[model samples]
Target: MDHLSTTHSCMEHLKSQNAKKSGIKKSGGKERPESSFVAFRAFLSSCDLFYIKHTCNFISRRVQKHSHLVHCHLDRTIGNNAWSDLFPRARSHYLIFEASDHRHIISTLDSKKKKSVRLFRYNRTLCDNLEITQLVKEIWNTSSACSVADKITRCRQAISTFSNEFYVNIRKLVQLKDSLDAALSASLPDDDSSLG
Candidate 1:
């Protein structure tokens, strides 16, 4: 099958790359030569990369949870539904970006819009319960109820209130500091320069 062959080839490529990386490293030591490619390969082998990979996985999971659709931009022609199945939630759209000379897939998470076709591949309880289904329907069918103008007005009002309070407090502090400094200067022996 094509899937099996593709999987095998991918595994083989990874193995070869790993072998090449190990070959570049100094014998019995992790310190790689100062060559740029060797440094990059060493970075791939580093434990920090494992942490970064885990962070990427976390981001992907979060995106999947929040979004039902994904859009991908890639240059090369891909197989039937290979990329789609990888992120099969609701509606997955892929576009080919041909301007970039190199072959790389750029994936973007699409916005959750009203009237989006719901993909119920998760827990059955989510769809089976009437209340849950109703909730999901309400979430998908209705756009943001708040108007942009109302949101802007509220934000501006908050900023104005904060600014007024901040300036008032600052003026009081400044007056208190001036009074304190005058009192302190009065208590001290007056210098000729200060009197002038």
Candidate 2:
């Protein structure tokens, strides 16, 4: 939700300043009408019911072309402790004043690290295979290092290499089996005379 009262007042003040420069009588040095302030205060009070003012960091500076006023208010729940979960590290920034009358206000929320998804793939052909069992036994018995961590690392590397090689071999065997089956079907007669 954007609160534009500060911007509206700034614009009114600018208009009044321009009028004074042109020898026009200012409205008793009052830029905004009394009724407008009263209405704005009422609106703020109503907003206070649902949100608490988190910060009063004004982005625009008074030295610039615009007035330094709290045009944007960062609000959060009064009793909600889960603000971090919603916004993480929330911050406000004032971008460079460009061609616009007012400087752009930027609000940012720091993103949390996302959890990585774990994938588990199983190959039934590799299970209970004598070659796979022998490969594991050979790698596990190999004296690559004296330390347990080093040995475990070596074993993991060996198993990964073996799995890659096994997968390639399995794919080749499957292709061969499919080609042999196709050739056998093609050689068989379409008619039932061969069955007799």
Best by lDDT: 2
Tens digits of lDDT, candidate 1, 11-85:
111212223333322222233344635753454344222110011111110011132322111121122233334
Stretches > 4 Å off in candidate 1: 1-36, 50-95, 108-196
lDDT of each: 0.33, 0.40
Please give, for residues 113-148, the per-residue lDDT of candidate 2 as tens digits: 458764435456666878767766776678644577
True-structure lDDT of candidate 2: 0.40
The superposed Cα distance between candidate 2 and the true structure at residue 33, in angstroms, equals 3.6
Clashing pairs in 2: none
Give all candidate RMSDs, comma-separated. Answer: 23.4, 25.1
Best TM-score among the predictions, by candidate number: 2
On a 0 to 100 scale, what is the lDDT of residue 78 in model 1? Answer: 21
